[model samples]
Target: MSFLGLAHCSLPPQAESLRQEVREFLAGALAGRGAAARAQSWDGFDPEFSRSIGARGWIGMTWPRRYGGAERSALERYVVIEEMLAAGAPVSAHWFGDRQTGPLLLRYGTEAQRVSILPAIARGELFFCIGMSEPDAGSDVAAIRSRARRVPGGWELSGAKVWTTNAHRAHSMLGLFRTAPEAAERHAGLSQFLVDMRSPGVSVRPITDMAGREHFNEVRLDQVFVPDSALVGTEGDGWAQVMAELAYERSGPERYLSGVQLLLELVRAAGPAAGERARVAVGRAVASMVTLRQMSLAIAGMLEAGANPAQEAAIVKDLGTAFEQSLPEVVHELLGVEPDRAADTDLGRVHAVLLELAPCFSLRGGTREVLRGIIARGLGLR
Candidate 1:
C-alpha cells in the first residue's frame, strides 16, 4: 500500500441538511456575538452555549447511544465541526471533551468511569483538558518527569504540566505520567490517568498568552492521589495511547479553520471590486482550504473505519497549521491595512486579534519540526 494513502471521501447527502440546520442556528444564536468573540474561533469558551449545543445532541455524535451519544456517523460529526468553525461559534468549552477526550475515555476508561463521565461530557455539562505538554517536555512526551508512585488503592502524582489548555476551567484531565522509572527504551513505563482537577493537591494557574487570553494553564499535581480506577487503558501503555489520541487531535477541521474568520473578514474587506492581486490571494487561500478539507475528511473516514492513520494525520496537521499560520499574514498583505483596535467594526477587531493569535497556531498540537519528523518516520525516510 502507498504510504500517503489518502482515500476519496464524499459526505453523505444528509450532511447538507445538517449543515443548513447549523447555519440557521448560528444565524440566530450568533447575531450580535461580535467579531472579537468570534475571533476566538473554536477557542471561545461559553458553557451556556456548549450546553445549548449538547441539548441539540451535537456532542459525542459518533459514540454508542448507551453513553448519551447520538450514534451518528463520524462524517455527520465532521460536518457539524466544519460548520461551527466556519461560523466562528464558541465551542472551546466542550471541544476537547467532545472531539478527543470523550473518545479516548470510551476506548480506554473503565465501565464505571464511562458511566460517570461520558454522559456529562455528551451533555456538555463536563469539560476536559489535555495534560500532555510540560515545561521541560513540549513535544517530547518521553521527557516528562511527572511520576505517580503506587500507593494503597491509588497513586500519588507529583509533577507539573504546562501549556495545558483550559486546565483552569476543566473538570478533569487525562494526565500522562511515569508509573515507573524510565527504561533503557524511551517509551516504557509511561501511563495515563484521568485526574479530577478539583481534587486536593491539584492546582491550576492561568497562563496569559501574547494575546492577553488566559486559556492555557500551568497544572500542578503535588502528590495528588488518583485511584487505580482512573487509569486509562493499561499500565505502561500511555505512549501508544497518546500517539493514538493525537491522531484524533491532528485530523480535525479545527486544525485548519483557525484563521477562517480572518479569511472571511479579508474577503468582506476586499469586496467585489478587488484588484487582481487581492483576487489571486483570496483564490489561493480558498484552494488551500478546499484541499485541506478534503484531506481532513478522508482522515475522518479512516477513523470511522477503525484505522490508525497517524502518519497521514501528521501530514494533514502539518499542512493545516502552515495554512492557518500564513492566513493572517496573507490577509494583512492583501488588505494593506494595519490591525486597528480602535476602529468601530468587527473586521478590524478580528484582524487585530488574529494577528496576535496567529503566531501560536503552529505551536499548538505539535510544532512544525516535530510533525515533519513524524511524517518522515511514517514514510520510512528516517
Candidate 2:
C-alpha cells in the first residue's frame, strides 16, 4: 500500500530534447488551426494528422523496435503526448491504440497477435476503441452483461456497449465480456477480446454530446463471431488485465490538459492591468496544472520501473478532472463573459467549446465517485 510521494520526477535530457522537436513539428503541422477547433483537445480526430505523427516515429515511442516502435523511454513518449495535447493535435484517430491497446497487446496478446496488429497500430493505419461500459454498467465494469460463448472455432459475442468513444470510426475494439455465470466473486467470470469493428453483426450508433459532436457511440453486437485467437491473455484474467489497462488510461497528460486551450485564452483576456481576482484565478489554475503534471510524470516513472501505480493514477485523475471541469466556471466568473460558440473572437469560441465539453472530463476515464472509491480502498479507509 505504498503511495507515490509528492517529490517531482524530472524527465531525462533526451526527453527534453524530444520536447523541442515535437514542438517544432506541431508548429508546422497545426498551423492555421483556430482556437475553437483546438479546444477539442484529445477528442479531435484526423486520420491524416495521425498518419503524419506515425511517420515521425511518435505514435509508439516506448514500444520495441521489432514492433515498429522507437524503443524510447516512457518519459520521452510523455513529452511527445503532452506537446501534441497542448498544441491540440487531432490525435483521436490513433489515441486508444497508442495509449492502451498496443501496450496491452505487448503485455498480454499472443506472439502472432502482436506481430499482426502492433505494427499496423504503430503505423497509425489501424484505430481502436474501448468496449467496456454498457448501458446497464458504466463505471462499474465488473457488472458488464455482454456474453461471449465459445463455439467450435470461435466465440459468439452478444450485447450492447454505450458511451463507446470512437467506435464509429475505429477499426477494432478491445471489448470485455462475460464468459461464465456470475459467481459469489463479483469479478471472476469476465474476459477480454479483440473484436474487429467490421465484423458482420457489429453496429455503431453515434451519441451526440452537448457540444453537438458525435465522438461517443452505442455499439451493438449481435452474435458477433471472433476467432479464438482474439482472446487477450488467459480467460478469467480480464479483471486484473483491465485494471492495469485503466492505470494507463487515467494517468496521462490528457487528464489535466483538457482545458489548456481555454486557459491560454483566459490569460490573454486578462491583460497586465487585470483585477486582483482575475489574476488570482489564473495563478491558482496554473499551480494546479503544474502539480498535476508532476504527479502524472511520477506515475510515468513508476510505469517505466515496472510498477503498478493504479491508486496513484486514480488520485491524479480525480484531481485533474476537477481542475479541468472548473476552468469554464472560473473564467465566466472572473472575466464576466458568457460562452459564445459562434463568436468571432478566440476567447469566446474556446470558452464556449470547453464550457460545453467540461462536464465529460470526469466521466471519460472513470467517474469521480469510482475514482474516490479506488483511492479509499488503496488508503485502507474503506
Candidate 3:
C-alpha cells in the first residue's frame, strides 16, 4: 500500500481560503493583462506581473518580516503559485529567484548578503538565475569547471553557464564555481558566488528555444569580480548547499503545472460529462495530478519541519515530468483536435505551443535519467 513509509497528506483549512483569495486575485488582476503571448511561463519573463505579485506580498510570502517578507505558511505560498500557474501568468521573471535562490540565501547567506539582496528579491525588483549546467555536464552538476580564484577583496570568476533561463535579463546569478582545483571527490573544492549581471566582465547571449521564445541564454563569466561577502555559507560546503537547494527546486507545483492548462482546455472541449472512455481518461489524469500534488505538498511540510527530503524530491520531479508530458497525447486521443496550428485557429495557438514545449519538460530542473539514478541509489538499488 506504501512505497517509502511516507504518510498521506491533507491541506489545512487555511490552505483552502488562500487558494480562493489567489483565484480572485488572478481573475481580476491577470485577466486581459496580456494576450499576445500564449503561456510563456517559466521563461516567460514579465516585470510588471512580478511587481504586482510583490506588491501584494506574495513574492516571499513565507519568509521573515525583516527581509520584507510576509512570513506566511508554506501552504499559503503553494496556493498562490497554484493559482498563478492556473491563470497562465508570466511569472518567470522572479520565479527562479523567489522559488530557489532567495530561500536558499535566507537560509545560508551571510548577514550582509541577506541585508543587501533579500529585500530587493522580496520586492520583485531584482531577478536572479542559477548558473549550474555547463556545456558538457548536463546532469552531472559536480563536473562544472567554472573557476573562481581567490583575490584581494574577494574572488575572480571565469567560465560560462549554458541553458541558463532568463540570464539575459536577470539582475544577478548565483553561480557555482571551482574555488580550488578539481579533486578526486567531485563534490569537493567547489564554491558558489553571487555574480552581478552588470559587472564589467559579464556577458549574456540569448538562446531561443524551439518555440521561438528568447527565454534561455548562455551567460559568460570572464574574470568577474565578486566581493567576499557575496559567498553564501562556507566555501567548500557549496556542494551540500546546492543539493539542499535542489530539494526545494525539484519539489514544487511548477513540476506539474507545465501541461495543466492544456489538460483543462481538453476537459472543456470534452463537455460536462463526456463518453465513458473520455471520462475515464480525464479522471485518470486528474487523479494523477492530485496524487503528485500531494507528494509535493508533503515535501513542503518536511521542509517546514527543517528536514531535507532530497531523494523524495528527485523522485517527484522525474515522475511529475513524465506525467506532465503525457497530457498532449491523451488530449489528442480524447479530443480529435491535433497540434496543427492551422487546424483550429481559435485555440490552436495554445495546443501548438504546449506541443512545441513538451520535450523540454524532462530536460529542465534535472534530466529524467539523473533523477531516476538518484532514486535508485536512495533505495540501495544502484
Candidate 4:
C-alpha cells in the first residue's frame, strides 16, 4: 500500500492547457524590465517571481478555492510544476510551501492552522523550510533528537536542524521535534511544530552549496515557544505526517528537471552535429523524463483521489534523480564541453553547477537507500 497504489491514475486534457499557460508566462518573464536573474531557477529564490506565480492562481492550484486556490486537479498543478522547473524560474522562494507543506497542512493541519497558513502560502507572501534532518539524524528522521517539552500554553523546543534549505529566508519551518522520549516509543513521542524562524530563541546560519548558493542552513532552536495550535495533526503523528509529505516532495517535476536546463542547453548547442550518439542520448533522456512525468501525474491524480502515493513517489524519486543527475555527464559527453559550469561566462558553467549539485538530488527528500527500502517493503520483499 505504499504510494497508496498510485502506480495506477490517468491524466486529463487540462494538464496540457496548464502547461501552455505556464509556457507563455515564462516567455514574457524576460520581456519585462528588471526581470529577475537567477543562476539556477529551481534553487534560485525570487520573491517577485513567487508572487507572480501566486497571482496567476498557480501556486496551490490544487487546493480548495476558499483559500485563494483554483481547486484544480492535482494533475494540473503537476503540469505547472513541470513547466516551472523546465523554465528554471525562481521558485525556491515558495518551493516548500507550494510543493509540500501546504498540501501536508491541508491534509493534517487544524482548521485554524489551515486558514492562517494556506492563504499566505497561496499568496506567495511567505516561505517555508523543512526542519526534519538533524546533525545526528541526517536521513534517520526517526532518530531526531530535537526535543520539545510541554509548557504552559505551548511547547519549549530545543534542538538543531542541519541542511535546512532556505532557512535564512523562510518565514517558518515545519519543524519536527520530539515531544516525548524515544525511550517510550521510537515514533510515538514525535510531533510537528510550526516554528517561527524569527522567534527569539531561533538562530539560523546559511550553508553554501557547491554552486556557491546559500540555499541550505543550520537552524538552532533554544527554548523557542510554539503555541499548541501551531502543532500539525495530533500529538504523535509526525512520522506518518512526514511520510505523506515526502511523497509530495519526491513526485514533483523538480526531481526530474534539476538538470533539465543543462540538457536543453546541450540540445541547442548540438547544432548541426547532433549525431546518432547525441540523438540517442537526448532522446533517451527525454523519454525517461516523460515517463517520470507520467508517473508523477498518476501519483498526483491519486492525491486528488485522497490516496497517499508514497511508494509510487519513491520509485519516481529514485529514477528522476538519476535522470537529473546524469544530465551533466551526458551533456558533457554529447557537447564535448569542459567540466566547469561553475565558472561564469562559459557554456559549461550551468552543466558544472548541475554536476556539483547532483549528489544532493537523492539526499534532499530522502536518501536513495531509504527510498529503496520503502519500495522493497511495499513489494513484500522486506
TM-score of 1: 0.97
- After superposing candidate 1, which stretches have Cα over 4 Å from the reference? 1-4
What are the runs in model 4 whose C-alpha is more than 4 Å off? 1-10, 31-39, 335-337, 342-346
TM-score of 3: 0.95
Task: Give per-model TM-scores.
Answer: 0.97, 0.97, 0.95, 0.93
Q: What is the lDDT of residue 101 in candidate 2?
A: 94
For every candidate structure, what is the RMSD over all alpha carbons to the true structure, in angstroms?
1.3, 1.2, 2.0, 2.6
Q: Compared with the true structure, what per-residue lDDT tens digits does model 4 show for residues 1-382?
A: 4454656556677788777888998889844422113327657788988898899998988889887778998788877877777776778889899988999998998888888899999999989999999999977789999999999998899989999989999999998988878865577788899998889999998888766778789999999998888889989889889888888887777777788777776776676677899889989988998788777777777777887767878898898898888887787676675676444433467776777778988888888999999899888998
Error at 77, model 1, angstroms: 0.3
Model 3 score (lDDT): 0.82
Q: Write the per-residue lDDT of candidate 2 for residues 87-198, one digit (tens) a residue.
A: 9888899999999999999999999998999889989899999999998898888889999999999899999999999999999999999999878998998999999999
For candidate 1, lDDT tens digit of each residue in 59-152? 9988898999999999999999998898889999899999878899898888888888888998999999999988899888899999999999
Residue range with the least summed lDDT across 10 consecutive positions in model 2: 1-10
| Predicted structure 2: lDDT | 0.90
Q: How close is candidate 2 to the true structure, as a TM-score?
A: 0.97
Ranking by TM-score: 2, 1, 3, 4
Clashing pairs in 2: none
Better of 1 and 4 by lDDT: 1
- CA lDDT scores, all candidates in order: 0.88, 0.90, 0.82, 0.82
Which candidate number has the best lDDT? 2
Model 4, TM vs. native: 0.93
**Per-residue lDDT for 1-382 in model 3, tens only?**
1246344567789989888878888888666743224355665678988998899899988889998899998878888887788788889999988998889998899878888888888898999989999997788888898999999999999998999988888999998998878878889988889988999899999888876778788988899989998888889888998987888888888988788777776676678867898889889999999889988888777777777777888878887898988987787676666576555543455667777888998988888988888888888887
